[model samples]
Target chain A: MDKKSLTRRLGRPVLGTVAALAMTAGMLGTGPAKAAESFKIGVVTFLSGGAAESFGVPAWNGGKLLIEALNRGGEVPAPYDKKGFGGMTIEYVLVDEAGGATKQVQEFRNLVQREKVDAVLGYVSSGDCLAVPPVADELKAFLILYDCGTPRVFEEASYTYVFRTAAHAAMDNISLARYMKSKGIEAKYFAGINQDYAWGQDSWADFVASMSVIQPGAKVKTALFPKIFAGQYGTEISALMREKPDLVHSSLWGGDLQAFVLQAGARGLFKRAQVAFSAGDHVIPQLGNKMPDGIILGARGVNGLAAKARPNALTTWFWDAYTKEYKVFPVQAPFRMVQGLLGLKTAVEKAMVANGGKKPNAEELAAAMKGLEWDAPSGRIQMTLGGGHQAIQPNAIGRTKWDTAKGEMTLIDVEYYAAECVNPPDGTKAVDWIKAGFPGAKCK
Target chain B: MTLLRSVPAASALAFAALVLAGFVLPDWAMFLVTMAFAKGLVALGIVGLMRGGLVSFGQGLYFCIGAYVSGLMANWTGITDIFLLSLLGVLAAGAIGTIFGPLLANYRGIFFAMLSLSLSMILYGALSKMTTLGGTDGLNVAAPTFLGYAPEGRPLGLALYLYTSAIVVLVGGLMRGLFNSQRGLIALAIRDNELRIEYLGASVRTAMAINYVIAAVLGGLGGVISGLAIGHVDPEFSFWTTSGEFVFVAILSGYLSIPAVFVGSILLEVVRSFSNLYFPNTWQLALGIFLLLVIVLLPRGLGSLTLRRRKAKEQA
Candidate 1:
């Protein structure tokens, strides 16, 4: 071909590609009006690799189920009519945090700004949650923090848009201390093995405070906080064993939790002292049947419990629905997914009523999230004002009961503890609180 | 026409324009733009090494060191001012780089790459172990201060960004000057045939050692800028994966031009954001595939690929 013809041909293709891209983008930009009317909820969670298969996978399943239920419920009527806002159909966009704070922050931005999501639900790691709180506040998006249990969220509870459905480190630590006291076990020496980060550090602080209150003169024999994403833990385990105390507390979760359990079991660390793991659900069932009996375990939230009294119909319905859908009972962290959905429902309902039965936008939604209370699968949840926003809720602590007949690990003496009793008083800086001596700072 | 000779005036003007736009743009755009400049700085550092045929995969270590130094210093000393912290950060990384450069200057091929990767991992391990620096939680670094003005929020941030970017571009110009000089010729000689350069009575190790220090200083500056841009600095900034990413940016841009590195970094961030927006689940896979094709098909990197093809056709 001649140069003129060849140049013309190339130009045509380049122009055609640009035109095509623009047209395609325009078509996508204005999706059918009906599709645009739907209330889109973006669910961000780690879903690949070993960590996802356990905590994130189950949490996603729970979130999926809740979305299905919300869609099935249709427009609000009767008692819920006051709460119903727009003719909204709920949809979800799932994102992976991938175990990085910066990545998770960027993901949050993409969801809130680019995707124009109405609400966000799902996070299983403390790092992701910590990374998100400031951004969520800045963006003014209604963020339902489903499963990051670090107390830092509450400490930074000034963000009116953020609300957590899961139990915090304070509740878990305080509940365990109270439980131990009730059991007439006053242990003097204490040791801890937790994943190194804000969550682990907060857990240790809360545990020390509560333990000191219940059993005075409790000496911290050892405190080991290993980096969270480190693959192997033989060194950390050996160190914990060497520090040998009368009691050991751990807050490791996900793959880290399983690795710790396996190594501790193999190395006879579990058998050394009475072990109390906060968020022990990650190791149960998958290794529960194999876990040596009488380990004195507890997950952050109550799961796998069979109450002596007849359970509530809603509770029964939730369990049946969850089991039928997932083919397994809900565990600790994922259980927050159901709680998150329930909390969001409560917020939406309250907002709708407050707006005089009108549909709410992002700002109204953000405002409604603050000071909201709801009854969820885990129990009552309350959002308190502090830095950005934080929710204090009930927590369940239970022993790992293996029923040889059923071939499972169950929570036998499951007990619910109020979060307010153990939580550090609001408006107090963490640095000052630590220096002043935690839950017992004022009490003493 | 020489490739480097074609574009200085245009780039200088473009950098000025970006700094001005940073003020009017919203938070998100400001974040993205600053990120582009920071990544651009790192790319420039890699360009220095690439000029000598050495592919250093551990720029992340230097970047992390810069960031951590600023973060640690700020938190420990309550010095939230941007200029002081950044200068201190660069100095800290440069000092450490001098030590590391000598150790790495003698190695070549896969050995050099592996050594850099190991160094980054070692830094990651150390940072994670040091709880006072916030460990895995990382230090929440504050924004830079300029002459008693807080340059973090909106208006002032834009001005500060402009000042910082101007320095970066000026540094790029300086790099260009060096690349066109005697030292650059010898570096190219090393790239062509190190054995011949050594036989010519030049101490290759000493030359490479100086080159290593230069790259380290550049990488450290990039790190400090990135830490300022991102608002937080963590140990992951020093991980092997992060280091590999810098190397990927270097490879993607090729060593054709100083500004190509900036474009490459911007392109990477843009592609990542775009991929996440559309593909969601398999975006990383898509990125991998795209990068593979680009590397295999355009081995000279994105900057050189178009020019190389056009030049060849013109010659024919």
Candidate 2:
């Protein structure tokens, strides 16, 4: 074929294809330009994977219930009575937070850029929580990390659009330690076994620091950090038994916690030491009668069975709604989720009122959330830490009593520590504050 | 020989098309393509290994090494240059592969698979325990610069897409060349009959070791690009499931052409993304069903469709 004919043949098709692609692009660009009638929020949690049953599913369920209640209008109490955010029906894009931090980052971007969600609330993994904030900042999207317990998300970087609605991992351990102190439990030599990850390590560090402050003479005997999700704890349990410390502390959760409890209980490891779990409430229902009696445990906050038995109106509503739908009692994951949605609802409403009942932009929403205080099922959650980007909430720790008649584990002798006592105050890092004997802490 | 010679021109054309796509495609599509290409490079490594009758179940070891090297470099040294970080990642993976290659090359079948898996798990265990690397939370990678120019938002995404496309094309061409080379043939021959290769005075172990190192390099390249693209790296990169995903893509590609790996990766991502969107509760089941369908319909994999068509044309 001659060059002219070849060029004529190829050029026409190429030009036509380019025109078609441009038209398609133009059409797609027009699709999302229409003014949104509903306030879209992206809810990301573990819909699959190992953490799904304990953390991801429950949090997602909580989010679903809250959204349903909010959309139903007047189902929740005042300040959140309006249907959704300022009478705009709440629509959600649910994204699974299973595929690691890298995948979560991509999914986060998709939620903001593609799904065009105004706000995002959910992250069960500390890794994902840490990874997502910068992206949220970059996109100028409002993000509320509901379940991840990492304090480093806010400490590592300053962000206006990113806020964690639940207390950091530090609060759980500090409360557990303080509860022991208040109970006059003698723990001179303490041993700890945590999952070898950020959440576990941070919890252990905080626990040690809090113990040092509360029980000034206490010393760390031995500590074991088994890998996260390590189903087998034979060696670690044996090591803990060999140490034979007066008190054993752990922050392991989900399946790992369940597996450890079963293995340790069978091995009579609990008989040798007064065991304390910083975040063990999630496993109580799963463990049932298998859970040992008189074991001290915390639920990251005043959540699960540890929360007030004669609950307030909001707590009763949330517990009932969640239980009706999921057929299980609300755990820390759901507690955090409910708190996040409630806080988001309040902030969005405030912003909407400021904007004359119009849906607030990301900046307005973030502004409303900063330093905001609201009631949660657990108690009041204040964005007081991380320059009002991280939450500080009261946490309850108590001893577990396995009721054979009920075939369930219940928290008895529950003690609630005020948020100020558990969380590091403004301008002070959690680890630094704890190590410095909780300077200026208001322990009650 | 013809196929080998055509690789460069084909790669250049593909590179141009992808570069154009970077500008034309929407943000989400561009991001998805970038991810698929990055993952495809790892799948390519698995493809190479599979061609030699070896299936690695722990390519994630090298992948995580590359990701961590890039992430740690960005975190500790403030080196945001993608080129420098990727080079370091490749070198790090290659160094680790070289150290372990001799030991790994001696095994085959499930033994080889399990050994590689064990090695990756060891890295996963170590990474999960190391607080300096942020433990399970891992560490964030700073936004990378291109030739000293830092870009953000759309510009950043476009830049990353272009850079990733260029790497994919270059690596694809190199892989094609390797497959056509004498050494590649020797490796394939060893897979079929190691005794014959040994009798012919060619060391099967050395060939296997070389292939292993090359696969490691490819995996590391994928890891670095992905880690940089996603702006985070964690121990999950080295987890067994991560490696299994790569293997799944390799099988889906049927150890076929270089482009097949990319296609397979994209398909997997699409299935995963859409499933997660529509069937949040049963996304895993969706993926399982899709895989079953693909296996049942196209036992050799999705790439077999193209091969079968080509064969039909040749016969006619």
Candidate 3:
């Protein structure tokens, strides 16, 4: 048990381990050396969490499929036919967004500072979207917010390095109210049951504001703000039934939406009053026939069944490829993720063209993406809001019916709203615009 | 007692080495190390409680208070000075501890743990509903400046890392000094038998209260550093899961050494970061397995290794 004998036993292994660590550390710091080689993207989504099953997993799945296809080269349609991001060979570093905002910020810094990723496409949570932008701006890294629906991201502050290539919550709710009014669905009174957090609250506020304008005389009977992911809706449904309004509006999605449909449908609340959901079409495939007929829904844009009727070349290829891979029709989550990735790819390639067919830096990428208009499976998306940072895309609303042959709930009487028809103009906030009676709205 | 005289010199050298490493380490590595040190301070507080045979599950109470105070100061006053923010955090958390410490000293064992647990959860619930305070999404903190000297990017990260290391060194030395003092021995005696200490006229309540106050101060300081380093603060700072992490590090390092706490914390961050990088899908499974192995093989924790080596030397 002498010191010399203990040292003899442990010294070699300890020294060897230390040497290995040092070598690895050196390898990790091989940052800019690899920048000229391939275009590295940090694709962050929820690999694990409650959101993983329905939202995050599908988003990452679609992202992986798209990135791999892009790497394979010429699979995607025109203008995007070139190899991985103008033939630089697109590489990805996937990080889970399951952890909270602080963890996300740290991981973001790691991606840019350590991993040397040229750009990052991430986040399905609104909190994370708002949290990451300042860090992105500080680190001078280009970040594309794939699916976070918070308007506050671009509304609160302008950032040189941040962009959300998918439409925020305003369009979803605004489109819902406009669709209801255009169809003349209901006359007098309405109630709402939405989640209480930022997403739900913001959605409810937007819907109410839209209702106040579009359906001017409709009185609000009641509004219930259930907590996010509060799966049970018994009491909320009971309260809604008790109010006995002509219509019920909700922005509930994912599990909360599913649970509300089941609980309220069992109580025959839908029969008592017409129900409309913002961002609800993703649940149709999961709900099948159980999703009540005559219920109105939006896929945040021309997504899911709304896009089924319009199969352009790019749309047809993306739709078939995604269905072939995942074995289910693509929903809003996957569609939004693909849209963000596609937009990022287009921007990178555009920047490369300007840079004489070389990799573009963050500033170059940002410049290329500013006010960029591009095609998506959801139709054309334009950077028209938040001073060319936030996206404004076409969105649709439809009435659902249980189709016998399809053995699923499918949208009927679908109506598409152009990007300008739903989203607010640049320098105008969504709520303020809605409250001001949709001034300067282009409805054609 | 004479053997303890070299602690200040040894610790100064150790701290000097750590600060020097900040100059050479990459920004991300510096950030990771900064986090380990900040979180390690909370573990050190838990270790302080461990010495007194009390485990405070509500250390998050102080942690959150420290963070919110510091964050609010930055947001409200535009004073982004790290020293002033940390001073506010320490003072606010210290005052809260002073008020609650004696009340908490009245309980023991599970009762003590649960009481602390409830206090933090209350803060969590309360913060989640405050819209002006940013609610569940929380508020962002700007990168703090060092005494009016604003550093950006690499230099900023390095400055924060070095500053945090210096604080840890000073506070850790204070803790080490307390452990060697007669008051520390009295706290340990209170742990062994409160009834005996009371019978010996040592005022067990006062000793326990003092120990609690020390933990609150440590927790607050740790919280301020963490909140500023991460550049964001939220109710999650007070969540039970966050407190549980501090406890986990405390158990991993044991109460034997202050330096061992940072090692354990760094080990955890490294394991977590690498595991997540390598195994994105099942990183939780990897982390759970790693923790299980640590608990099984090192019952007294990694700190026990040092204790065993010292004992072996004595025997030889």
Highest DockQ: give the candidate number. Answer: 3
- Report the lDDT tens digits of candidate 3 across residue range A82-166: 8888788788888888878767877887788888888999999888887788888888999999898878888878899999999
How displaced is residue B135 in candidate 1, in Å?
2.3
Error of 2 at A260 (Å): 3.4
**Residues forming the 10-long window of minimal summed lDDT in candidate 3 chain A:** A11-20
Task: Return the top candidate by TM-score.
Answer: 3
What's candidate 3's DockQ score? Answer: 0.40
lDDT of 2: 0.85
Question: If scored against the real structure, what TM-score would every candidate get?
Answer: 0.86, 0.92, 0.94
Candidate 3 lDDT over B168-276, as tens digits, reads 8998888888988988888888778888988988888888888888889888988888888877788889989889989999998888878889988877777777667
The DockQ-derived docking category for candidate 2 is acceptable
Q: Estimate candidate 1's alpha-carbon lDDT, on a 0 to 1 scale.
A: 0.70
Write model 1 residue lDDT over B201-306, tens digit each, in one string: 8888887888888888777777887776556678888887777788888888888766678767766766666566566667788678767755654566756744
Pairs of colliding residues, candidate 2: none
Worst 10 residues of 2 chain B by lDDT: B293-302
Location of the lowest summed lDDT over 10 successive residues in candidate 1 chain A: A75-84
lDDT of 2 by residue, B1-316 (tens): 2563487788888888888777778787778888989989998988888888999999999999989888888888889899998999999999999998889999999999999999999999888878887888888888889989999988999999999999999998888899899888887787789899999999988988888999899889999989988888889999999999999999977865778789778777766776787687888898898787566555566566556657777799
lDDT (CA) for every model shown? Answer: 0.70, 0.85, 0.85
Model 1 alpha-carbon miss at residue A104, Å: 2.3
